[model samples]
Structures are given as C-alpha cells and as structure tokens.
Target: MGNLLGNWRFKEPSTVEECDSTWGSDSESDEPAAEDDSGISESVSPAESEWPPGNNGDLSPKLTDSPEFLPKMKRSFYAARDLYKYRHCYPNYKKSRQPNEYRNLRFYLNKIPLVPDGIYIEEILTRWRGDYDKLEHNHTYIQWLFPLREQGLNFYAHELTQDEIKEFQSTREAKRRFLAAYSLMLDFYGIKLLDKSGNVARSSKWQERFHHLNESQHNYLRITRILKSLGELGYEAFKAPLVRLFLEESLHRNTLPNMQHSILEYFVYTIRRPAARRHLLRYARQHYKPAHAFLWGPPPKRSKPKSGDVGASVGAGSSGIRAPAPTPEPQRRGGETSFIPASGCSGTLVSYHDATVCQDVDAESLNAYTPLGSSMDGPEGVFMMILERNNYSGAVPL
Candidate 1:
C-alpha cells in the first residue's frame, strides 16, 4: 500500500501528534478491523508516521496533518495499499493528511485519473444517512462508475474509455439500481424519478415516424420530446442555490433529455422536499413565456381601446400583465338563456327557469358570450351554456 501510494505527497505536513492523538484517525478503522486488540500493527510504515514529533510536545507545526490527506489516500491506495505498494506511487498525485471536509471530495476526485480508484469512505461513513440517502444512492454508482446514460456517454466520448463503461454497467443490475445510484443525491431534495421507459419503448416501436429529423432535431427530440411530454415528471424545482445550479448546469441547449433526467434525478435526490406546485408553476410562467395565441382559452375581449393601450386586449394592461377580467356570460345554445357569468369555458348551467325550458341554449345565441352584461332577470339578459363544439368558424365578436 505504502509503495502504491504513488507520488502522492502531502500537500501539507503530517505529524505524529496528529496521527497518534486521534483515535480512528485512520479512516479505514472505525471499529476493530480483522486485526485483534493490538490496534493497528506497530509496524508503522513510513507512510503512517514519517513526521517527527515536535519540541512543543505536539507534532511540528510544519507537520500538521493535511486537510484532504485521508480522502486522497483512501480514494487512491485503499484497494492495493498493502497488496501492492507500487500502486500508491502514481505521478502528479498529492496526499492530504489533515481533517477533510465533505466539500473537498470533488477537489480530490478531480485529480484522480482512474474510475473507481478511490472511495471517500470517511466522508461517506459519517454524512451518509436517510436525510442524505439520495446522495448516497446517487454516489453508489458514481462511487464505482461514471454518472451517465448511454447517450451521454456517446456525447462525451472523449471523457471515458470503453473499459470504464463496462465497469459502470457491471456495477448495477436493474435500471432502477443504476438510476438510484445516481439519483440518491437529487432525491435528498424532493425530486422523484419519473420512469418513462414505456414512452421510450413506444417511440422505439414507432421509430420510423420520427426518423426524418436531422441530427440537431434528433438531439432536441432526445431531450424535449420524451422528457417534457412526461409532463411534470421532467421538471425539478428545489431551493434557490440548488435550483440555480440545476438550471445553469442541466438546462443548456446541448443537454439531451436523458442526460437532463439523470442530472435532474441527481438534483431531485438532493432536494429536501418538492416545493409547492404553485412555486414551480410560477417559475414555469416566468421562464417558459408561452405566447397568447398558443394559449387554449378564448382570445382576450377587446378593451374600450383605452389611451396609450393601443391594440391591448381587454385582459392586458399597458404594463403587459394579463389582469383577470370579469367572468364572461355563458354561451346561449338552444334553450332560454340563463345569465351566469361563467368563470371558465365550462361551468354548471344552473337556471332559475323550469328544467323543460332549460334545454340547451340556442347555438346561435351562444356566440354572444358577452363579458359585460350585469344580470339575466329577463329575456334581454344573457343565458349560460357551454359550447359543445369549440370549433367556432365565425369571426370573434369584439
């Protein structure tokens, strides 16, 4: 192990006092390992205790343990440490000897060239819990493999080797296991993984219909079509910083949906709770910017043509915010009209008139869905009826 400790030098000094003073300082040992009560062997390899004790009774200030030493060492040399000493002598590697904070795992992992090379066991052992179960699950695969789908692997071909992909595939049995491993981090938050395998299957079965798209269109389809069509499943909304991180990281144009879903699952696994649906809706409205013509409801009624408001619809003010207009009278179909200001396109057609007289409102009169009339006490007043056929071929009345 010591030999395998590659060229990993302690970025900071390590000391006897630091190693000896702390029990379980060795990340590998929390409880007694296979070794009996002698604690770890006093064999004391150079890697374990090279630093001399100081005159101050503590180890020399220059020899204080590195902050990231344990993680770096654990990740790199753990498997072959005693098995093969030369494994630790890699080029360009630095050994951290101090107390490592969780946030520094990336800093260390970023330096390692091999996949599944090191396990941040100490960090995982301590912080790994139900509250952070999602993260743990996500890192399970990431611990042993890369976090990517087949398409993502293809997209980032240069980053991983074929052997690495094989290693990743071998680590998990089911799709969920693979998903859960990468999903744990995001699940910590309130994001749930939405399985759209059926949709994928359906699309596969009918591949010819979608084959006409060019590569860019295919890329877009790879993301938006399957992912978004799952409706709310594809989205992940969390607290501010995480949300911002996801939007910036996962929502880029080149990002494929499969990748988006994985990254989103990773983030969702991290979220503590699914934020209020309305909160998500608010973000959608602000970000999606759906156009008025694309909206399903009737076009906004013509306003009185207020000054400075130029072709502004009745619902929209100069500020461009769509204000809620008063309820519009129901469509009068065949029967006597009962004036009810319908809140939406569909409403209960309650009438004070007798049930027989309350047959369907006249279809012609239904077109006069006036938004303004006050009451329906007499014949002059409006009657309410839902339009059975939404196909109104005639021009929209102002």
Candidate 2:
C-alpha cells in the first residue's frame, strides 16, 4: 500500500473544454471561495515566526471543522492516483495524435504559466484560461475532467440543500454526481467520520484492496477475476464479490479470532454516512445464521423389555427417546478478514479458519509462489493476485 502511494504522480487535467456545454450551462455568479492556507502556507518567513502563532491578518477563511471532511480530503488527495498513468497509457494504445493535436493539447495544458504555489485550482484557472480560451466544452473533455473536479465537489455537496443542489447543478450537475459517487467510495474505503471533537465517530473498515478497483494486486486479483468474468467491469463490479467473499469466509470458520472479527464489526456496526446507511444495513443483513442439516449413519435397533423393565411404560423401553434437539447456532455478525503478505511484506498469503471448527493451517506448511519479483512495495505485489504457490517469481511455502 505504501509502495502504491510512492509511485503515484499527481495529474493535472487537460484544459480542453467540451463543445457540448448544454448539461450545466449556467454562468458562474457566486464568488468562488478563496483557498484556505491557514494550516500550511507557501510563504512562511522564519524571522517573523512565533511558536504558537497569532493572526497575521484576516486572510484566513473560517473552515467548517466537520469530521466528515476527512474522507473528502482523503479522496481529493488520492484521486490523482491514476491520472498520470492513465494519460500516458491511453495515448499509446488508443491512437496516435498528430503533431498539431499534441501542440493544441500542450497549449490547453498551459506548458508555460505563472501558477502561484499556494493556490491549487484558482492558480491553474487564472494562468491557463488565456491558453484555454478558445477550447470547446465537449463531452469527451467533460468525461475526463469530471473525475478530477468530482473529488472536491463531492466533499462539499452533502451540506447543500435541494435549492443549492439545483443551483449548483445548473452549472455543475456532473460535478455533483461525481461527488456523490466519490463519497460512497470513501465510505467503503473505511475512512472514519469525525465530530467537532475530532474523535472517530466511525472508522474506515474496508480493506484497501476492495476500494482500489484499478490496481492489480494479490488480494484484489480475486475480485478482478470475478469482475472480468462479468464483462464491462468498473467500480460497481466489486460490490458482489466483496460481499460474497466475506460470507463464505465467515461461515467457514467456527469462531473468528483476532482483530479480524473487528474488521466486519466496524464495517457493519458503524454508521458513517446518513444517506447510504440503509444500503449498508440491508447488504450486511444477508450474512451468517444456522439452518438444519440431516444426520445420517447407523440405525438404532429396538431393545426388548426385560423382566425388571415390566414396571416401565410400554413404549419407554421399546421406542427411541426423543431428547431435546440441538438448536441451530446463530451466525456471527460479520466475516471479513485482514490480508497479510505471505512472504516479505509483499507475498500474498491468505488463510481462513475457525480453530474450533477445524485444524488451523500453519503458514510454514502452506505453498508459496513468487513471480514477477515484485517487492512488497512494488505495483505487482501490492495490486495483483497470486493464488497458488506456482504463480509467483520463486517457490515458497505458503
């Protein structure tokens, strides 16, 4: 996971605006909120610094300290995870662009612009608008840029009212949808919601593998396999696989051990978002509970009454006794487990067991496969799957 982070290069979107600007065509009127830099500023001078710090001026905008903001921050931070790679990969495989086309792209990207260090979107907008002025706001352009802008807008839309949604949607409806989807993704990733006090009102409980649908890694490979089988895979394809995997794993164990139990607990037990709370509850309700199973083996023979058994009731000795039948066991509340690397910090080793239900499998006795020589921190190791021992770069015991 850490390796995945290091390899990430932030992408700046191409300045191509779509020609089909009909969707959210309203003009911008509200003053764009000024960028907040109180926490960390680009221009801090050592000579004027104070330890605890005091107000330099009224430059700081009051920010809502809502705990819900953390996931937004996280999403905005991580959204760039695929931008650079996607930009590079697409041009090579899809089609070759003409030289002028490339020049047009570079112009839109503002290859030369005086962007201020502290400002993010505002700085980019200010410097690049000149180069971007003649560009059309086309559908293709929207599809690409929407994902980038969605991260920030999604974080802010929850606070909006119906009127605000309508007003905002007039110019940025796609932006709103992007935010809605992003918020769902962030919740699934297990980032906790906070209150004013900064306590964990809810903690993120989903594994990183489940949330990162794009990356290839051992834990995610199973999910991807299932997804590709379904055809036309996307983020939504992971939902069923994730749910079913948890169910099967939970039922296989007689008793869940370790913090593994808490993984499911946090996922099911916590309420991080108000709107999707019902959806999560409904999905979680389908897991774990006992049902009757037929017992089959040798049949019992009827015993004949002896001389002393005459005092007993006629059927007592002859008939089989019907003791109270065993009641079915209730299912565990959740079945999720944490994944650990089989070898080094990168090899994939997966084991599910309920020690009381069956014998525990030792890691040493398990088979291992090392392929691709991916370091624990490498992309292949972190994002792809290795199910069997022969699948890896080297032979290893599971």
Candidate 3:
C-alpha cells in the first residue's frame, strides 16, 4: 500500500495568469533554475502572474462535486493504485531566482517555485498526490502541501509567511486547489469529504487505511498541521467530523491503540474554532475511559451504576460481567502548558495545549511553534539557516 500511486492527469483550465505556467502549460521539468540567488526576488508581480489558472469561472461546488462527477474522481484516484511506482520525484534538484517568500504562492498558482526536494507542485499533484505509498512513505511532501510555521522533519520544504497566508486565503482558485489537496489526504486517512452531500464521513477504504494509520508513526504531527492549516485557510467547518472519527476509532472501538494522547494533545488542540473544540472535548469526555481522566478534567463524582440504566449496561458488557474497581483519578495538565518533546517520545505532540478552552491566544503564542527566523525570499539563505539552527530541526520528527 505504501508504494501504490494513481495515475491522474492534471486537468488544465482554459487560461492561466502567469503565462499559464500550470501542468497543462509546461513540461514536468522546466528550464534549469537560474543558479543566481539574488535574482529570485519579487521580480514578477502576483497580480500579473502568480495566480493559478482560473476554474474557467465554474467553481460552483454543485457541478464539480456532483454524484456523477465524484464516482469518476474516485475511480481516477484508485485506478492505478495497484500498479504505480512507490516513489516518483524530480530527476534532479535545481535552485533559481524563485524566492522562498513566494514558495506557496508560486506553487499554488502553478508558477515557478519548485519545492526543496526539487519536485514541481504540478508533478506532486499529478503522480504522487493520489498514491497511498508516496503519501505515506515520502516524508517531504506533507510540508509542501500542509505547510506549518515550525521546522518540519524535512528541511527542504519552505516556511510560510503572513503575507503569503493573507494572499492565499483571498485567492479563490488557490482555495479550490487547497481543498483538492485536503480531499486527497483525507482519502488516504480513510475519511472522505462529500461536498455535494454537504457532509463528511468514513469512506469504503476506512478500515484498511485506519489500520495503516494505527501502525504508523509521526502522523499526529501531520494531522495537527492539517487541522491548523484548514482553519488558517478558511475551512473551519471540516475539522470536527475528521476529529470525531479518529477519536471514535481510538477511544470507542479500540481500533487505533496507544494513540489517545496524540489525538488529544496534538490533533484536537490544534482546532481553531471555539465551538467545535468544546463539542469535541465534551464528546471525548463521554467516550474516554476513567484511566484517561487527566485529559478532560476530573470525572463527575463516581457512584456505582444502578441496574437497568445505560451506565449499568455499559459496565455489564465491558470486559467482564461485573463492573471493575475504578482507578484513582489523575490530575489534569494545567492550561497553557508547552509539551516540549524529549528523546524517544511515544505519542506525537504539539508544542502547547490550553486546558482552558475559552482562553484567547496571543499572536506570538499562536506562532510559538516556528523554528526558522521567518519566511524568506531567498532559498539559498534559508538553506544556510536550516543548517545553522538545531533547536527546531532536531525538535520534532517529520
């Protein structure tokens, strides 16, 4: 499964802003990136060139995500999964004047920025994006797709900027493609987002993908970055159900073992919506066992369950005929706690967790996780920065 890739061609729009530099407009590899670093500044303006091709003015979610269209899309993704290569990448690495400041911009617009691994944005979306093996085994792609402010395991992917975030948020075409990226990754994780139905649910591939998820490592961080980026990019409505499904498998069905900590600390805490966070916390409180009491504050005072009630019913079939002794409660981790990672840490972790759900996060605290000095225009300078700093690069696994 880790080596499987689907062969889906990038369907080009009728027009593009930057000379239509999209996959349809150019070869998988472009000219040798100019070796000079200083020339890669904002030589070209975004208004003139840095937008991805328009959807031909036809992005009415209704038609694109229709019942008729989705079946084809699903087939397209899974058709060659059984036969494609495990890993496909650029033939060689190249550096040019396309600065890191415009990395997300150029990639989203299908313009001139190649990721640190030298893979073009269009190529990843075409050959590797739908592949289960490439998505899982290829460690560098996630950083380019769901980029975070922090230092990821891969030093190759670019850091994000505030200006890039604001512009990307406002660009309609970028948002559409971002959602496409989100959908592909969700399919890999066994959850499917249904735009036509206006809902999200487990896909037919759920069981197998869920199994692979439990057996893997470092996905909690990936998930946290995804959840955080979704909210940052104006997709708040999508986080809850995805979180609920994972929690259900882990806390309810016991299918995803030893991941309760990662789900709560990393994935759940990264949620930006206040209402959704509270709802998920309440749901977790309902499903989590008494041993995990530290997670959602103290349990309501314990009393023996009376016969014929729901509590008594839950106890009767849970392992033995008789209810067992309750373990003493563990104290909750105080709010505003920073979970610095130690060597050989088991569950994936976030840098911080706010036990108090209603508290407001300051701007710096919001980005307290970043390791780089900041986003830069020159990849040459950033590559040197990556080498000079060990605090962030060594802190977490990709």
Top-lDDT structure, candidate number: 3
Model 1 ranges with Cα > 4 A deviation: 1-158, 170-177, 194-287, 290-398
Give the range where candidate 1 is weakest over 10 consecutive residues by summed lDDT.
Answer: 35-44
Name the best candidate (by TM-score). 3
Superposition error at 169 for model 2 (Å): 3.7
lDDT for 272 in candidate 3 is 41
Evaluate all candidate structures by whole-model CA lDDT and list the values in order: 0.25, 0.24, 0.45
Give the 10-residue window scoring lowest on summed lDDT in candidate 3: 37-46
RMSD of each: 32.2, 27.3, 23.8
Stretches of model 3 off by over 4 angstroms after superposition? 1-100, 196-198, 291-294, 298-398
Model 2 gets an lDDT of 0.24
Candidates 1 and 2, the one with greater lDDT:
1
Clashing pairs in 3: 2-133, 40-97, 52-109
TM-scores for every candidate against the unseen true structure: 0.19, 0.19, 0.51
lDDT of 2 by residue, 85-188 (tens): 12222222222233222221221233421121222222333443323221121112221122211111112111112232233334343333333333332243
Alpha carbon lDDT at 28, candidate 3: 29
